[model samples]
Target: MISWIYLGIAVLFEITVAFSAGNAQGFTRLWWTIATLVSGAIATFFLSLALLDFDVGVGYAIWTSVAGVGIVVLGAVFFQERLNLRKLSGIALVIGGVIGLRLSGAA
Candidate 1:
């Protein structure tokens, strides 16, 4: 449960990363980028809190995989993005890898 919260934070961190990437140049965009970076750091702190209960490796792997999945989903749903079978299949690989890690006692 706590690990899941960290996973959420990791996803938010990734979302902020995307936000920053989308607006790295313009002075007007600087506000958004700063907000994104600050929020990301805050989100990552919450993520670190979950490490209190879980092993560091498990926390890292779970957070990383969850963030990866979340970004792809967000991209498709929120950004009018296109994800063909190849991309979807790649995401599936991520899922498989996460599951494999869990099954192998990494989680």
Candidate 2:
């Protein structure tokens, strides 16, 4: 239970780092670059903690899936990126896979 919470936090940090990286302008911006680095470090630390209890495959799949979905939605909302039908379908598939994994007792 606690490990899942850590994983969720890790995913949030991962999304934050990814979004900050996009705004960092190839790391040319100071504040955004720092945010990306700090958030990435925090995400990694929590992911490591989660790995203590979870299988690597399951943990990594869930982490990346959740973060990927979050980043995409944030990009669409905050960055004004396009979200076409194809992209929406892809997101649905990824979400479905995440649900499948969770239901498989992959913890």
Candidate 3:
């Protein structure tokens, strides 16, 4: 349970990293660049903590999948990015994959 919490935190930070990196404009923006780096470090740290209780492969897969989905949705909602049917389908597939991984009893 605690590990899942850590994983969730890591996912949020990873999402922050994505947005920050974009806002950094190739690292030319000082605050956004710093935010990108800091969020990435925090995300990795929490991911490592989660990995202490989870299988590495499973943990990493879940982390990336969830964070990817999160970024897509957030991009649409906050960044005015496109959210068309194709992307929606991909999101569904990724979600299904995550569920499959969780059910495999390997995490």
Q: Among these predicted structures, which one has the highest TM-score? A: 3
* TM-score of model 2 (CA atoms): 0.89
lDDT of 1 by residue, 8-107 (tens): 7766776677667567665367777787778678767877787776688777776766677777788899888898898799789888887887688766
Clashing pairs in 3: none
Query: What range of 10 consecutive residues in model 2 has the weakest lDDT sum?
Result: 98-107
* Per-residue lDDT of candidate 3, residues 1-107 (tens digit): 89999999999999999889989999999999999999999999999999999999889988998899999999899879999999899899988887786788766
Worst 10 residues of 1 by lDDT: 18-27
The TM-score values for the models, in the order shown, are 0.75, 0.89, 0.91
- Model 1: lDDT equals 0.74
The digit string of per-residue lDDT tens for model 2 on 2-85 reads: 999999999999999988998999999999999999999999999999999999989988898889988889889987999999
Name the regions of candidate 1 deviating beyond 4 angstroms. 26-28, 53-58
Please tell me which predicted candidate would have the highest lDDT against the true structure. 3
